[model samples]
Target: MHRGREAPICTRMSHPLVFDRALLRARQARALALGPEPFLLERATEDLSERLLTVKRRFETAVDLGTPTDLLSRALAGHPGIGTLMRAAPLAAGLAASERTIVADEEALPFANGSLDLVVSALALQMVNDLPGAFAQVRRALKPDGLFLAALIGGGSLAELREAFAIAESETTGGVSPRVAPFADVRDMGGLLQRAGFALPVTDVDRVVVRYGSPFTLMNELRRMGAGNVLAERRRVPLRRATLLRAAEIYAERFSDADGRVRATFEIVWLSGWVPHESQQKPLRPGSAKMRLADALGTTEKPAGETP
Candidate 1:
């Protein structure tokens, strides 16, 4: 939790985790209805494609867990390495489904254990109310040595915009409301992967700095990306025009570069893990080494717990 920031009431154990699942579905529906452009999803899928290209192995079957947009599906559709590609939507929002698309909740996947060869998600997992539950479902759906890869917004994403909103609300309304969702830290995500039984877990980040004319453009892109404020504890009323104006001003004042455009940081956290199999390499056990490091490096080594 951030200092001077109280946990949202909906997050309390006595109450439910305040993510409005329906609101999330509605936002995606609205975004698809309003704009056909998919900037954020395209960029994220591009990164995912790079990772996919690195694998020398092939998959007989693969699943794209969340279908916020068709970017990922299009990328994988023609790949010769993957024999069958399927798409699943978290919500049944009347997203037209082909024979390949299905409506299944990530938290409660219907796939049988050890069924899939690969599972990949891009820019979708952050909004799930129960990440661990979702990950467990993914693990169960994968065959032994099956791979899981995903990329989502990290906790550091949109820091400038978050600060701008908080400061604007505090100055205009004398209090702040949740306008943005809290993203999971990378370390926490790695731990969750291990807890869900994913082996050889790997986590890294790709930080992107996008310059916008002002904060308004940033907010506009977020809507198109289906990344809206769906927090159950978010303010119910519409934001005051005065607050919006103040926020833009503060954003420009603090985050603008010499070019006069304000910058928004997008920290994309990438996760990779695989199901354990005997074919996979294992780390050597302690005291099982065949050669000493000092002998290899030609340097005298000091024993542990002793001064150099």
Candidate 2:
């Protein structure tokens, strides 16, 4: 791996910090220690690996970025097309001593410019405060035509929990505090990729709905996944018992099914882009086509002022 000076952390944005990254890291470490459920990370790894299979090119150097578990790295291990797949975690606790792992922050990657052939992240990057800046750094770190593919928790995730909490808090305490981390929307992702100077950017969402016995069960799973509310503006006071009970009741009333199980939605937004290269496809310049649209379609041409 090509090592460079640690990239400066880009935390400030036009808006205030949306996440408490330090707290998030600590929670993630604790979750790991507690043997958090691996279902979500496993699903993301499978999807990302399948997506990589569709591309025929071999990557001489690649990275797994900050996935909480080693599932992604292990899945890619011994893949014929991948030469040296390194795993990077935000903290040391997430690293495996037996594997080629590095402690690197998503916001401040330590890679040299144009040094990587590919970068894949699964179920990470959503907590980043300066997401655009992180994307820009990833773009800068990739060789021309190198690919960046990631799956992160999207905005549609936990809609039920968010709504239930809001209504319950309002009804019980007269106000609602930030209880969930804000996620990235799929709609703005393409523009973010373009802004980061990546070419052929593609973004899509995979919505997964998991059913649980109750809202409390789902909340416990989230904490075990290290994805509990870590908002910088989150309420420091513990949630009132009345609010918690009310939220559970509201969740059951609104989101429960025939079997009396409640649903939790997780939207995994997949993003992919490439560093620009001349060999890649390019859009035709305006008025540069040899065949006119009318000729190609075998239809009569109509002027702007004339109706067809």
Candidate 3:
């Protein structure tokens, strides 16, 4: 909780120190080697594009930070409100087609202060080591009333896989090692948006369930998407074949449906907000409203500090 403003927001705070930037980059490059299946990226892009279409706010210039695939570039081009759009990738530098695609890090955004009308990130911020710093940078990069929209893997994602890995490791190696990266919950993420100074922030989780033949198949997809565990506390040694096989068994036994296909969860958390501006509506302070709840609701109401 925070105080002292019309809308409460936290100051500079803790970084997500668990993620490894170098490993994340390496995995991202590795994923690209499989030539872009892009199922998740496409879904994220569609959701983002749909949300943008509903908003009345017209952005003249926009930036897609930490673009995982080329889908974002096309998504931006379809929206008529944006005049220009830039794609910033993490691994590739200065790849130009029609729009400029420059390599950029999410932890350290390259945009000048108040330089953008809109900043959109997809499937990118989850790997950022300093998420607070990254959000703060996004807030700073926006002009007054500039909008920010992003979608990332959320806390509810991949629960079955994480549990199976832990149980298998504990049973096989007599120890538990981190096999999945933790994600922030939507409620907590809403606070983070405000912590980064976003006004009227909104956060929600969209849970997606996909069925696979086995956990190993799921792992292959995650690897191909460059979304595998890159946690600093992850096991340094390779996973034993016996342990991997056991984990697969556990996953199938626990998370599989009657049809024998195992379920995998991908909870996409969408965070939306805008820079503070005079034009936006704000909540009135306590006791400052012209009308009372009694009048509005047509009922007898007792004032606070009075017990009736």
Give the best candidate by lDDT: 2
lDDT of 3 by residue, 1-308 (tens): 01222332335466547988788877877887776558878899999998998888789778888878777877778587787788877653223454366566887666767778999988888777778788988898788999999999898889999999899989999999888888878878888889889999998888899999888889999988888788998888988998999999999999999999999999999999999999999998888989977899998887688877
How well is each residue in 173-230 modelled by candidate 1, as lDDT tens digits? 9999998789889989889999989999999988889899878888888887778899
Q: What is the C-alpha lDDT of each candidate?
A: 0.83, 0.89, 0.83
- The Cα error of candidate 2 at residue 81, in Å, is 1.8
The true-versus-predicted C-alpha distance at residue 203 of model 2, in Å, is 0.6
Which segments of candidate 1 are over 4 A away from where they belong?
1-16, 91-94, 301-308
Task: Write out the backbone clash pairs for model 1.
Answer: none
- Judging by TM-score against the true structure, name the best candidate: 2
Which segments of candidate 3 are over 4 A away from where they belong?
1-16, 92-99, 302-308
Error of 1 at 218 (Å): 1.8
Q: Tens digits of per-residue lDDT for model 2 on 1-308?
A: 55454443544457468898899998898888878888998999999888999999999999999888788998999887799999888773378765588888887887878888999999889988888988998998899999999999999999999999999999999998989878999999999999999999999999999999889899888988998888999999999999999999999999999999999999999999999999999999999999999999999999899967
Question: Which regions in candidate 2 have their CA more than 4 angstroms from the true location?
Answer: 1-15
Model 2: lDDT to the true structure = 0.89
TM-score for each of the candidates? 0.90, 0.95, 0.90
Worst 10 residues of 3 by lDDT: 1-10
Global fold similarity of model 2 (TM-score): 0.95
TM-score of 3: 0.90
